[model samples]
Target: MPYTPVNVSLTLTNQQYVALRTVNGTVVLPPGSSGRPDAGGLKGIIVVRQAGNSYLAFERNCPYRPFDACALVSVDRSGLFLRDSCCNSQFNLQGQVIGGPSPFPLRQYSTSLQGSQLNILN
Candidate 1:
């Protein structure tokens, strides 16, 4: 089956917004980087690798529990992993709950790439 597409707008600083283009393919954006705090709420980042290629976008929120704050996924030299300082939940790059009480993965959104731009949707 084909994937459904969604549209989302993110408010980011000039620097953070500029960095979005650096990501070539599937990438995870951590808080204080691509994501920024807005009046509406915390906005997450969407990183697209290539046009017409695989695309991934997700919310910074954790799907486990409401009280369990600090659910943000980060990727570095060690790779992608979900870190929740409150509950100490750690997930793999695929958003699988490797450890902790999370029964489901992180909230993921549909993504599409157009030229050098990426569109993230619900």
Candidate 2:
């Protein structure tokens, strides 16, 4: 079964969001991330920064075989996709499966950007 993380409500300052400002830039936060149970009982969160201040956040565990924490996905060398080395699955910045065994896209979280704070909400 695929893991669905807990609800998330996070605020990021411009300075903090800078690191993830570029395309394919990623940040992983622990399960109890930003002081909340964001990852439910799974490993953590995998966030990929996209253009237009949009962001994509999903559980670190790969949907193809989430039971194995080692199946977590990482940004490919090209910085264009998230690749799960274990399963050789590749997901686009938007969490959609581009090349992989996963039948569904990565689970996503809602995000919004204000003057400077970027909020990741459930």
Model 2 agreement with the true structure over 1-122: per-residue lDDT tens digits:
55444655445553544558677677776765446533332556677777767777776677887787677777787776788899998888788899978887876767776755555545
Candidate 1 C-alpha lDDT tens digits along 68-93: 44554444344345455656667664
Candidate 1 stretches with Cα past 4 Å from truth are 1-6, 9-43, 46-52
Candidate 2, residue 108: lDDT: 72
Pick by lDDT: which candidate is best? 2
Clashing pairs in 1: 6-121, 6-122, 7-121, 24-49, 25-49
Residue 53 error, candidate 1, Å = 2.3
Top-TM-score structure, candidate number: 2
Q: What is the lDDT of residue 18 in candidate 1?
A: 53
Each prediction's TM-score versus the true structure: 0.56, 0.73
* Model 1 per-residue lDDT at 13: 30
